[model samples]
Target: MRNTFDFTPLFRSGIGFDRMLNALEAASRVETVDNWPPYDIAKKGEDDYRITMAVAGFSQDELDITQEHNMLMVSGQKPAEDNAEYLHHGIAERAFRRRFELADHVKVVNASLVNGLLTIDLKREIPEEMKPRRIEIGSVKAKPKAEAKQIEADNQAA
Candidate 1:
């Protein structure tokens, strides 16, 4: 099925959300189905996340996971065995590249592989000043009468 929608009005509105618009444009260009390597992304806690990839025939030494420039890159290369005598080799034993976009302040905690599953953990650390805080609005009281009068005289002189 084919579908169409008018986007001219949105472009002309000038709302000034350039970052979101650029992200949408970039997402539209991505080919989701082309790279079929199975993977899973899960949230471990309030600020922790995990990414797991299914790599059946890959060795731990052949796989690599790295974080660079706000991007998580997972790659692997499997070399063919020397004494392979199988009539039909259906399993995928080739090189692959996978990318995951990381948010600001998010960082890689650690990575490990066990039982053909590669797990990568991540955590986001928010600064103390950035977190929400309670303000004592009602606790702030007015100054004394003498202090108020002195401030008034100073203001009048100014």
Candidate 2:
């Protein structure tokens, strides 16, 4: 059984959330999901995030990581091997591609591969102008009555 969601109600009341609603709609639709090369996403800090993938037998050169706008793609391709007979070919040695949707200002800070695991670090850096700031409310002082009377007398003498 497949379930879908209607985002029309949200659209009527929400503004500037088109991208988020579209992403949710895409996720709700069922598709052939490839489970190979399992991955994990964790939040290390307030604005720090990490994505780790189990890529056993995949070398650094064979893997590619790219970021286009708000999308993160990680793909792996193993060079074709010559005729090698295996008694039981149980290991999954195939090319696979994975994608992750990133929020605005979220950037890939670093990537490292260790012990057949690929770890990618991300950081969200909001611009100074976009951050919330405090506004100062100052008191408005009234002019003295003596100074006002002096100005009025000067105008009368002129």
For model 2, state the Cα shift of residue 22 in Å.
1.0
Local accuracy of candidate 2 as per-residue lDDT tens digits, 8-96? 99999999998999999998986798998999999999999999999999999999999999999999999997699889887787999
Which RMSD values do the candidates have, in order?
7.7, 4.8
TM-score of each: 0.69, 0.83
Off by over 4 Å in 2: 138-158
Count backbone clashes in candidate 1.
0
Please provide, for model 1 over 25-139, each residue's C-alpha lDDT reduced to its tens digit, 9 standing for 90 to 100.
6666646563546999999899999998898888888988889967889999876667968999898887898989887679998898899899999999878998899997666
Q: What is the overall TM-score of model 2 with all chains considered together?
A: 0.83
Q: What residue runs in model 1 are displaced by over 4 Å at the alpha carbon?
A: 1-17, 80-86, 134-158
User: What local distance difference test score does each model get?
Assistant: 0.81, 0.94
lDDT of 1 at 112: 88
